[model samples]
Target: MGEQPILEMKNVHSGYGSIKALKGVSMKVMPGEIVAMIGANGAGKSTTLMTICGIIKATAGEVWYDGKKINKLNPEKLPTMGLCQVPEGRRIFPRLTVEENLILGAFHRKDKEQIKKDIQYSYDLFPRLGERRRQEGGTLSGGEQQMLAIARALMTKPKVLLLDEPSLGLAPIIIQQIFDIIKDVNKKDGTTILVVEQNANLALQAATRGYVMETGEITLEDKASALLENPKIREAYLGE
Candidate 1:
C-alpha cells in the first residue's frame, strides 16, 4: 500500500548457459533513489545489470521497469523505455569523436534540437569532455572516457541509470570526481541510480540503500548508513 518501485527484480534467476550467476535474486529501487549493489569479483553484480537490460536473459522470474515486466523485451528497445545502462570497461566507440559518441546514445530520439541541448548539458557536466568533443574517444584518458560513457547514457534521459564499475582502473582522485558527478547527476537530473561496484566503500558512501551480494546471492541489505556501521559489512567490504 505504498508507492510502487521504479525498477524491481522478483526471484530472478539468470546465468550464462550453465553458470547460474544469479539465484533467485530480488531487489527494488524507488524513484529518485541511489541504490548500490556491492560485492566482490565474480559475485554477479554486472550480470544483474546486464540481465535487467536484456543483454543476459533471465532464466526465471521477472524484471519490472517503470510499471511493466521487461524481462522479455527486446534489448535494443530498453533505452527508449528509459532504462539505460553504462556497463563495465567504459565501452565507448574508439574511433568515434567524443560528440559523435554522445549523439549515439540518443539514437532512438527524434528531438534533434533537444539532443543538441543535451549535448551541451553533458559538456557542462564534464567540462573536460567539452574540451575534447572533437577528439577521438580512444585518445581521451581513462577518466575522460568514463565521463563520455556516462554523458552518452544521459543523452537518453533515462529514468533509471544502471552503472557498473564506474571507478574501475581510475586513479583515486579521478574516482572521487566521478562519484561526485554521480551524486550531482542524481540530484540535478533527478535520475534514479542502481550502481554495481566492487568498491563497496565508495558505493555505500554514495547510496541511500545498499545490497551485498556473495556468490550470486544477496546476503545483506540495509540503509546505507546502517550498512556502513554493520560489523559484517565493515569486516567484509569496508576492509576493517
Candidate 2:
C-alpha cells in the first residue's frame, strides 16, 4: 500500500444546527506535503478544517489522523497530539505580547529546551515577528497579526498544520511574504500543511497538490501545477 495519509476526511458532513455546511466533503493530506484547499468565501473551506480539528462535529463521516479515528476527540485535546490550526482571522491573544502568544502555543508540551529553540526558529522564519516579539499582538498591522498567528501555530511543532485563509486581507507584498514563509516552513521544518485559501493562485503556487471546493463539495483535485494551468480554474478562481 502507498504511504498512509497523515490526515484524512472521508465524506465528512458537518454544519451548525440545521445548516449543513459540508456536504460529503472528502480530502487528504499526505505526510510532509503542503496541500491547499482553495475555494470562494462560504465554500465550507474553513468548515473542513474545523471539522478535522473536531471544533465542528461531522454529522456523518470519519476523520482519521495518524491512523486513528479522531472524530469524537475533544477539540481542546488536539493540540497535544500535534494538530494545530491557524484560523481565518489570525486569532492571536490580543493583550499578549508576540512572545507570550507563541509560548502559549506549546502549553501542552513538556519539552522546555526544544520549545525555546522553536521560538527562535519562528523568529528566523519571520524576522518581522522577531522585531516585534515584545509588542502586543493587537497592536501589529493586519499582515503582522497574520504572521504571528502562523508563527504561533508553528510553535506547537504540528504533524499536520491546518491553515485557514492565510491570505485573507493584506497588501500584495505582504501576502507574498506570507506565502514565501509558508513554503519556508514546509521545507525547513518538514511540517505537513493543509492550507485553506480563497486566493487560488497563491495557494496553488505554494502547494504541491490542491483541492478546489465549491459550495461545500470538492469539484477538483490535482497537482498544483496542473490546476494552475487548467483553463476552468483560471477562469473561475484565478480571474482569467
Candidate 3:
C-alpha cells in the first residue's frame, strides 16, 4: 500500500472576497481513518473542508489528494476523484424526492449496476430514507434530512467523505445515531472521512484522531482518545 495520505492540505489559505477564513491551515486524512476537526463557531473548520473539496479557491498553498496536487481542480471534477462533501445545512434539494437527490449524486458515473447497488446500500444505511424514497426532501424531519444528506453523499461512492457539522441541529439521540452510522460507514466501506463538528465531545469519541481549530489556524492535533483526555480540551470544548 502507498504511504501518502488520502487527503492533505499544506498551508492552505482561502476565503471569500477580502475575507480570509483559513490562514495557513495544514492537516491530513489517511486512508480509512475517521479524522475530526473540532472548534467553536467561526473557527474556519468548514472553510478547510471547502478548500480541500475545491468549493473555495485556495489563494495560497497546496491541496493534495490520492497522491496528486488537486488545488486547481474544479469542484465538479472532485467527486469523480473520490472526493465528496456532505456540506453544512443539509443542502438536499427541497423539491426533489429522496431518490432523485440520490440519483443526482451519481450523475457523473457510468456504472449502472454498481450505482444501483450503491443506491440500495444507501437505503440500507438509512432505512428512514428508504421508507420515504419517493417523498420530497423538504418533507423529511430535521434528523431525517440529515440522514438523507449523508446518504446522498455516500451514493457518490467517495474514497474520502468530508462531513461538515453532521450533528448540527440534531437531537441528542439522533446525533448519537448519526455518529454510529458514520462509524459504520468508515469501518465497512473503508472510507476516509474528514469531519468538521461543533460537538467536540461526540466528535472526538467517534474519530480516530482529531485536530482542534481556533480562529483561522489549527491549534491542536492528536489521537482522539488523547485529545478527549486533555485538560485544556475538556475545559474549553468538552464543557467539563
Whole-model lDDT for model 1 versus the true structure?
Answer: 0.94
TM-score of candidate 2 against the unseen true structure? 0.97
Residue-level error in angstroms, candidate 3, position 220: 0.8
* Residue 157 error, candidate 3, Å: 0.7
Deviation from native of the Cα of residue 235 in model 3, angstroms: 0.7
Per-candidate total of colliding backbone pairs: 0, 0, 0
Error of 3 at 28 (Å): 1.0
Q: Best candidate per lDDT, number?
A: 1
Runs in model 2 deviating more than 4 A are none
How many backbone clashes are present in model 1?
0
Per-residue lDDT of 49 in model 3: 88
Report, for every candidate in turn, its global Cα lDDT versus the true structure: 0.94, 0.92, 0.93
**Candidate 2 residue 57 C-alpha distance from true site, Å:** 0.6
* Alpha-carbon deviation at 34 in model 1, angstroms: 0.2
Q: Model 2 lDDT vs. the true structure? A: 0.92
The all-Cα superposition gives candidate 1 an RMSD in Å to the true structure of: 1.2
* lDDT at position 125, candidate 3: 90
- Give the TM-scores of the predictions, in the order they appear: 0.98, 0.97, 0.97
lDDT by residue for model 2 (32-127), tens: 899999888899999999999998999999999989899999999887788899998999999999999999988888899999999998898889
Cα lDDT tens digits for candidate 3, 13-116? 99999999999999888899999999999999988988888889999999999999999998889888899999999999999999999999888889999989
